[model samples]
Target: MQRKGPDRRALETPRAAGLAGVVFALLLAATIVLMRLGIPEGVEAVGAGGFTDSARRDAVRAALALIPFAGIFFLWFLGAVRAHVGDVEDRFLATVLLGSGLVFTATMFGAAAAATAVLAVAHPAGSAPSLTAWDFGRHLAYTLMTDYAMRMAAVFVSSMSVIGKRMGVLPRWLTAVGAVTALLLLFVSSNVPWAELVFPAWSLLLSAHILLVSGRRRRVTLT
Candidate 1:
């Protein structure tokens, strides 16, 4: 007796597309939040002397808030693309591409969380030129270069927007932005204050397109 394979046709639906779009929006929003308030891990307000211990603690709180969402967004982004355009392209390659993006996102989240937690706990209070304070500062610097900085580079270079266009899920212009944004990340991530602006800005554009395009398609079907 021969067994039947799974029904592939049943997997396709407008509902799936809509859900995927929503997930993408969520991922974009989470990334934006993480960018502005998440990674710095310390130094909240510019202290009188510059960067007090309290400021550092605030940064840690922001980073912690972003950790779960970062991971969730990676997984969610994968599912969204898989649902939206899987049938139109090489599923395996597309999955690998998405997995690459997710890997970078996850790496950033983990590193940020670890770095923030360390800084939060080890932060020096008041004016201390003690051994511990120096060590903590060194730790912060290391994490900045290794975790946040590197991850930003990876996200920019990976350029899922390119893949989305090739797969017929997004416009070429959008992918171009992804490409430009990815490239910009390398040079600008250090600017913390400004680097934080990229994700929200990108998200708003993409989310608006998703909603508008998806809605227009729905109307055409009804007519």
Candidate 2:
């Protein structure tokens, strides 16, 4: 009986994951920035009396439009990474990773929905939402994004870091960066504006590393 060598398709998994991850990172970061600009926090958020400006409303709409694509690419990245890791993955950590990623995506969608509610306040079309409606919608959206979704992102980052450490796939520096990112998401993101950006930044770094590693491997295989 003859056993075949590893399938060439398998080698492409890391590349796919890398590309997906890069796209997800960029999209998510842009969405977050737009959302924040559209729905600013603090007393000024209420002071401004909310979305009187059509441009801000449009920015929120753009952010909402980007959310679905960001989530899709994130899922693709998640599945590809899992496929790349394959049978060597620890069951418990894998479960944690999958669970957190799913939760994060759902939370992001919830935030987008809340933001959409704010946009719909165009009751007669071009009319600003009542202050109360604006406040509630903005609060709900930020809460879901920073408090819930970012926490889930933290869980995903930390768990991936642990797995990478055990598997020796990620470099020590990258794992360290992941640890910092998780901590920031868990503790700082909810309180500090723009802190959630770390998650996407970390994702971009990880994706770049994966692409570099996979490219080297493919080159070596060819040689």
Candidate 3:
């Protein structure tokens, strides 16, 4: 009897997905950093002079441009993880992972839209946004990004960690890291400035692990 070869498509999918996850993490982290630098959280409202800093406006625009691509790569990353998990995945955990990932993406998009609205309102020459509109947009963007999106990311991380642990696909240290990241996102992100960066950091680590594992598997298959 001849030995069967590993499925090439199956071998490639996880690697590609891992790469997408890496890209997503970088883009998202950059977007967040740019937004933070460009829009500094404490601005209650534009003064009577109006917010007309061209440099900040350009930074915001750059952040906005990265968002869609980040979202797309995130979706690919999600699909890849799910595919790697395959049919043996627990239905409950899978549902949580999928739901949280999707909700996080949507919330992120909402935040970006709010940020874009802020930019649009300030774009007209010497036209200052009313205090009410400025405050509303600012609060809405932060709340969506730091509160809702981060919470959903916490859920996603916790669920994925549980799933990976149960399946023995992830190392103990990775699982521990995921748990800690989830806890931080859940309890600390909204209160602490820039804490949401943890999510992308964890994603980067996980993606790197996945890529490493995929490479080892490919080598084993080849041998």
Candidate 4:
């Protein structure tokens, strides 16, 4: 009987996916930070003249520009994760992962659109947005991001952690961290200013793990 060599393509796919996940995590974290700094949560100040500041407006524009790229990379990350999971994935958990990820992306985009709307309405220098418009846009953007998108992200994280635990792909501590991240996103994100950052933190750790595992497998295959 002749021995077959390792499949190079199969070995490379996980590595590529891991890189994409890392990029996606960095992009998302940057986007969140920029948006938060640009749009401070103050109903009265924002309604008055806070947005008229050039620096804040520019920060918001920068954040808006990064959003599409973040979303693009996120889709790539999602696809890579699915590929890594392969055919052995549980249908119910896989469905939850896919659905929640998609929803999170869409909801994130919608939140960006709401923020853009605030900018659009604020155009024409020396003119501040009406209280009603400012309040609506601000609340809508935050609600979509913190309320809807974060919750969907929680589901995605929880499902992925469950799948990884069952498949023995993730360490016990990593899975435990994912569970804690999901709980924070689900219950604390809306109330805490920076709680949503946990999602990206979890993503970065997972991506780094994936990359490490892929590197090890590649070395073993090449030897």
| Leading candidate by TM-score | 2
Clashing pairs in 4: none
Q: Tens digit of lDDT per residue, candidate 2, span 1-223?
A: 1322464566689999999999999999999999988888987686434577778888888999999999999999999998887579879999999999999999999999999998887566677778888888888999999999999999999999998999999999999999999999999999999999999999999999999999998888778
TM-score of 4: 0.94
**What's the TM-score of every candidate structure?**
0.63, 0.96, 0.93, 0.94
The number of clashing residue pairs in model 3 is 0
Q: Rate the local accuracy (lDDT) of all candidates.
A: 0.52, 0.91, 0.89, 0.87
Query: How do these models rank on TM-score, best leading?
Result: 2, 4, 3, 1
TM-score, cand. 1: 0.63
Model 4 agreement with the true structure over 1-223: per-residue lDDT tens digits? 1334336666666777778778888888988898888777855345547888777788889989988888888788888888778577878888899999999999999999999988887868647778788788888999999999999999999999999999999999999999999999999999998889999899999989988998998789769
lDDT of 4 at 13: 67
Please give the lDDT score for candidate 4.
0.87
lDDT of 3: 0.89
Off by over 4 Å in 1: 1-56, 91-93, 122-159, 190-193
| Clash-forming residue pairs, model 1 | 42-56, 43-55, 43-56, 44-55, 156-182
* lDDT per residue as tens, model 3, 36-151: 87666654244522346777778889999999999999999999889889678879899999999999999999999999988888846737667677778878999999999999
